[model samples]
Target: MTAPVFLVDAAALAAATVGGVVRLDGDEGQHAATVHRLTAGESITLTDGEGRGVHGEVVEVGKGWLDVRVHELVLEPEPALQLVLVQALAKGGRDEQAVEAAVELGVDTVIAWQADRSISRWRGDKAERGVRKWTNVVTSAMKQSRRLRRPTVEFAGSTTDLATRLRTVDAVLLLHEEAEVGIGAARFPQAGTVGVVVGPEGGISPEEVAALAHVGAQPVRLGPHVLRSSTAGPVGLTVLASRTRWTT
Candidate 1:
C-alpha cells in the first residue's frame, strides 16, 4: 500500500537528508498518532507542499510529535502547461466539491468565479472565510489524493473580473452548454496557463459568455450531455489531461 502522507515545514524537510530526522508535531502529529494511530516503525511520506517531499519510516512516537528517518525524497517539477479552473461559487457546497475534485484531478490552480447567475455570494467577512475554506478544502484533498503540491485557490468578483484576469492567461475556455464547439476542437497554447470557466447551475449568461469570448476566451461544450457545475470543471480538466500529459 502507498504510505500515509503528511505535510510538514519546508525548512525542516530542507535540512533533512537520508538517515536524518524529520518531525511531525502539533495537530499534524496528533492526527498521525491519535487519529491515524500510526506507530513506531510504520512508513510514512511527508511533503512540504511546494513539490518537495520525502518517504521515510517512523522511528519514535511521542504525545504530540513523530520522528521519521528519511529513506527517499523527491522534488516534483511544475508542468509546462498549467490548468486553471475558474469555477463559479455554487450553493449547497457544490463549489467546495468542485475545488476538492479539481485538485485531485491535477489542476494547478482554481479560481473562484462569481458569475452573474450564481446564487452563492462571497462578500464581507464571508469572502475571507470562503477563501480560507477553499484553501483548507484543497489542503485536505491534497493529502487524501497523495498530491505533493496543493492546488492554488483564487477568487473573481464577476464577469468583468474574469475578463481582466483572462488577459494574462495564454488561453481561456468558457464552459457553456450553448457553445457550438466541443472541448477537443481548440488548440491549446504552446507554453502557458490554460483557464476553464465553469458557470453556475442557472447557466452562463449570454452576456457573460460573450464578455469572456470577447476577451479571447473560447466557449466550448464537454459533450452532448450537460454536466453539473461541480462536475464540469473536473471533466474539462480530464479532457485536457488526456489530450496533453495523458494523451497516450
Candidate 2:
C-alpha cells in the first residue's frame, strides 16, 4: 500500500529539511499515532495540501503525536488545465456527495449553486455553515485520495450569482438533458479553467439555463440517460479528466 499522507501546515512543511525531525501532533497526530498505529521505521508522507510534500519515516511515537525524519521534499506542479464544478444544491445531502466525489476525481475548485428549483436553501448563517461543511468534506476526500493539493470550496450563491462568477471561466459545460450536444463533442480550451455545472433534483430551470448560457455556459448532455444531480458532475469530470489528465 502507498504511504498514508497527513496534512501539515505550510510553515511547518517549509521548515522541514532533509534528515531533520518534524513532529506531528493535534487531531491529525492523534489519529496517526492511535488510529493508524504507526511505529518506528514505518514510511509515511506529509503534505501542506498545496503541492508541497515531505517523504519520511516514523522515528518516534508519543501519546498523541509521532516524529518523522524527513527523507525528501516533493513539489507537484500545478496542472495546466484547471477543472471546476458548479453543483446546484439538492435535498438529502446530495450536493455534499457531488463535492466529495469531484475532489477525488481531480476537480480543482468547487462552487455551490442555489438554483431556482433547488429544494434546499442556504440563507444567512446556513450559507456560511454550508461552505464550512463543504470545506471539511474536501479536506477528508483529499486525504483519502492522497492528493497533494486541496481543492477550495466557494460560497453558495444563486443562479445569477453563479453566472456572474463563471464569466471569467474559459468553458462552462452545463449538464442538461435536452441539450443537442454531448459533452464528449463539446469544445473546450486545452489549458484553462473548465467548469461543469450540475443542476438540482428538479433540474436546471429554463431561466437558469438561459442565464448561464448568456454567460457562455454550453448546455451539454453526459449521455443518453439523465443522471441524478449528485452523479452528473463527477461523471462529467471523469470524461474531461480522461481527455485531459488521464492521457499521455
Candidate 3:
C-alpha cells in the first residue's frame, strides 16, 4: 500500500538529515493519531505544499500529536502545462467542490472569479473566509490524492483582471456552452502554460466573454451536454493536461 500523506509547513523539514520531527497539532494531529490510529514504525509521506515530499516513519504517538522521522526527500518539477482554473463563484457548495476537484486533477492554480451571473458573492470578510475554506479544501484533496504540491488559490476582480492574468500565460481557454467549437478541435498553443476559465450557473455574460476574447482567450465547448459549473473546471483541466502532455 502507498504511504499515508500529511501536509506540513516548510519549517517541519530539515536539510542536513533531509528530515525533521514535527508535533502534529489541531484537528489534523488528532485525525492522524486518533482517526487513522497510526502506530510507531508505520510509514507515512509528508509534503511541504511546495512540490516537495518526504518519506518518513512514525516514531511516537500521543493523545494530541504524533512524532515522525523523515528518511528521504524528493522534489518534483512543475508540470509543463501549468493549468490554471478561473472558476466563477457558484451558489451553495458548488464552488468549493470545484476547487477540491481541481487540486485532485493536477491544476497548478485556482482563481475564484466574481462573475457577472454568479449568485454567490465574495466581499470583505466573506472573501477572506472563502479563500481560507478553499485553501483547506485544496490541501485536503492534495493529501488524499498523494500529491506533493498543493495548487495555489487566488481571487480575481473583474473580467478585465482575469484577462490581464491570462495574458501572463501561454494561452487561455474559455469554456462556454454556446461556443461552436469543441475543446478537442481547438488547437492548443505549444506547451508552456495555459489557463482555462469556467463560467458560473447563469453562464458567462456576453460582455465578459468578449472581454476575455479581446485578450486572445479562445472559447471552446466541452461537449454536447452542458456541465455544471462545479464539474466543468476539473474536466477542462484534465483535457488540457492530456493535450499538453503534462501528465505523461
Candidate 4:
C-alpha cells in the first residue's frame, strides 16, 4: 500500500526533526491527524512542496499536531515535460474541479482565462480571490496525490495575456472541438515545455481560435465526443504527460 502523505511547512519539519513535538494546527493538520487517524510510531510521508520529501514516523500526538522524527529524505527530479493548462473560466464549481484534477495529474501550472463566451467572469478583486481559491484547491490536491511539487496558478487578462504566457513555454496546444488535427499526429518538440488551452462550456469562438493559431499555438482535437471544461484539462494533461514520458 502507498504511504499516507502530508504537506509540512519547512519550520514544522525542522521541529519534527529535533525530537520536538509539533501540532497539526490548521484545517490541514486536523485532517491529517483526525481524518487519517494517524498514531504514534506510525509512518507517514511529508512533502515540502518543492521537490523534497521526508519519510517520518510519528513520535508524539497532540490534539491537532503530530510530532514526527524524519527518517529519510528524498529529492525528486523535476518532470521532464512542463505542462501548463490555460483553462477558460467555467460556471459554478467546474473551474475549481478542473484545477484540482489538473494538480493531481501533475500539471506544472494553470492559467485562468476569461473567455469571451464564459458565463463566469473575474475582474479586479474577484479575480485575485478566484486565483487564491484555485491555488488552495491545487495545494490540497497536491498533498492528497503525494506530489513533491506544487502547481503554480496565474490569472490572464485576455487572449493576449495567454499569448504572452505561451512565449515562456516551448509550445502551446489549443484544444478545440472543431479542430481537424489529432493531438497524436502533432509533433511535440523534443525536451520541450507545453501549454494547453481549454475552452469554456460555450467553447472557443472562431476568432479566438484564429488568434491562438496566429500565435503559433497548434490546434489539436481530443476526439469526436466533446468533453466538459472540467474534464478536458486533466485528460489533456494525462495524455501530454504520457506522450512526453513525463511520468512513469
Best by lDDT: 2
TM-scores of all models?
0.97, 0.97, 0.92, 0.90
As a whole number from 0 to 100, the lDDT of residue 79 in candidate 1 is: 84
Local accuracy of candidate 1 as per-residue lDDT tens digits, 75-174: 8788888999999989999888988899888889889888899999888888888889999999999999888898888888878988998898889988
Q: How much is 109 displaced in model 2, in angstroms?
A: 0.2
Q: Residues 1-248, candidate 3, lDDT per residue (tens digit)?
A: 98888776567654414456655556766888998999999998877778877788889999967887878877867865677889999998898898888888888888999898889998889989988988899888988988988898888866777788888877888999889988887767655778889999999999999999998889999999999988999898888767675644
What lDDT tens digits, residue by residue, belong to model 2 across residues 115-208? 8898998999999998999999999999899899999888647877888899989999999999999999988988989999999999888998
Number of backbone clashes in candidate 2: 0
TM-score of 2: 0.97
lDDT of 1: 0.89
State model 4's lDDT: 0.81
Q: What's the residue-level lDDT of 177 in candidate 1? A: 84
CA lDDT, every prediction?
0.89, 0.92, 0.83, 0.81
Error of 4 at 225 (Å): 1.8
Query: Between candidates 1 and 3, which one is better according to lDDT?
Result: 1
Q: How much is the lDDT of residue 236 in candidate 3? A: 88
lDDT of 3 at 209: 90
RMSD (CA, Å), each prediction:
1.1, 1.0, 2.0, 2.4
Candidate numbers, best TM-score first, in rank order: 2, 1, 3, 4
Better of 1 and 3 by TM-score: 1
What is the lDDT for 30 in model 4? Answer: 79
